[model samples]
Target: MDVTGKVAVVTGAGRGIGHGIAMKLAQNGAHVVVADIVEENAREIAREVESTGKTSMACFLDVTDRQSVESMGESVINQFGQIDILVNNAGVIGAAGWEKRETASEADWDITFLVNVKGIGTVTDTISPHMKERRYGKIVNIASVAARKGTATSTPYGASKAGVINFTQSTALELAPFNINVNAVCPGLLWTDMWERIAVRFRSKDDYPDELTPREVFDRFVKARTPLGREQTPEDIGNATVFLASDAAENITGQALNICGGYMMN
Candidate 1:
């Protein structure tokens, strides 16, 4: 998985899984562009990557905003000459308290789709042309296990990830002719900010344990539900991503690999 000298762009890389992916790519010798909605976070991650003796640049990106995404792509191409890999990790769980479908509002649904599903399209649409012209590229989309099953508490989020899976297949088929691979990674229980919000929801339930903290609930869930008997880490997701983005996975495309601790095997 030697990605040395390759230029990679990771969205939503300020923190959490995206941050892990960016760091992993850098550690593997790829020049990483840490793009985030928060300029501070992007710069922070870029600095972290630079500290490891790897090249990096921070770019402010609003995935839902077409112009903003396009600008980031153009800037990266202008600076790096080409983008070898794209990791679409930017997404949202929607407005707090609207996780359940019955209580979910149209606004929540719209925002979730805009960021999770449509945002990937926008960024890929902006960068794929460059890859097409160069006849080489790797795209990794961050999906979720919920995408494969219906969730009572996370309907909209699940649907949005489902869209990501389908979009990955579509793009993989279309991009295959150009020698590009498109794939999706469905991660299980990682304690990201997104999961923190879910922890809040769990704490609010009457059945929630009295002595357990929000994180404890996650630990319990992992212990009881995950066959692997542990929660997945951001580094786990990052390793899978680097493999998918490397030449090692050249024959793999239109596939959704689960990094869910065997939580949702299919």
Candidate 2:
């Protein structure tokens, strides 16, 4: 999968899955723009990409803010000339402390939708026009397995990802005539701050094992539920993302590809 000279904008590229995706794209010869709300983290990741002898730039982006997203698109266009791929990886599971729907406040639901759902639309809307004019683009949205299976405790998070899947299909249909391919990547369990926070919530459950640590609980859950018997990695997600963004997956669009190691068959 060669993406030489392509320019890709990856939101939330400061850490975790987004960072991994940015690095993978850079390694594959794409000039990556690492966008994140945290300026320092974005800069650090951009530096890491540059260290690989690939071109990269850091942009301060708040995905929830439409203006900020638009600014990022404009900045990337100015710096890179054109945008060939857009990876919508910016998302949230809400704050770790509030897990259950009963305990989750209205603010929690609002923020979750704003960041995970609307944020994708915000960034894509800002950049897709460029692709449309050029008649070329690849968009990989970072959805979750939760989108397919609902969670008792994290209802809002699941709902938000579900919205991503639906949005991907709709966007793919609309963009297809222009030769833009839109797809979703559903990642399983990965050891990131998001999962670390989720582990904390699991440990609070009454049925949680007495001897197991939060991370142990996470590992155990993955081992039992996933047929692969292990946790997925950021690199795994990144590789899938790069493939989707590359010419290798040119014929694929509006599809949800799960990287959950058999946790989800669909």
Q: lDDT by residue for model 2 over 1-266, one digit each (tens)?
A: 79999999999999999999999998899999999999999999999999989999999999999889889988998888899999999988885457543466777788899999999998999999999999999999999999998775488899999999999999999999999999999999998988877777787566566577878879878987899898999899999999999999999999999999899988
Q: Report how far residue 239 has shifted in candidate 2, in Å.
A: 0.6
Candidate lDDT (C-alpha), each: 0.91, 0.91
Q: For residues 1-266, could you state the per-residue lDDT of candidate 1 as single tens digits?
A: 77889999999999999999998898888999999999999999999999989999999999999999989998998899999999999989876565333467888899899999999999999999999999999999999998988875467889999999999999999999999999999999899888877776676466567577878877876787699898988899999999999999999999999999888997
List candidate 1 segments past 4 Å from native. 96-102
- Cα-based RMSD of the predictions, in order? 1.5, 1.4
Error at 151, model 1, angstroms: 1.9
Candidate 2 backbone collisions, by pair: none
TM-score of each: 0.96, 0.97
The reply for model 2, stretches above 4 Å from the true place, is 99-102
Clashes of each: 0, 0
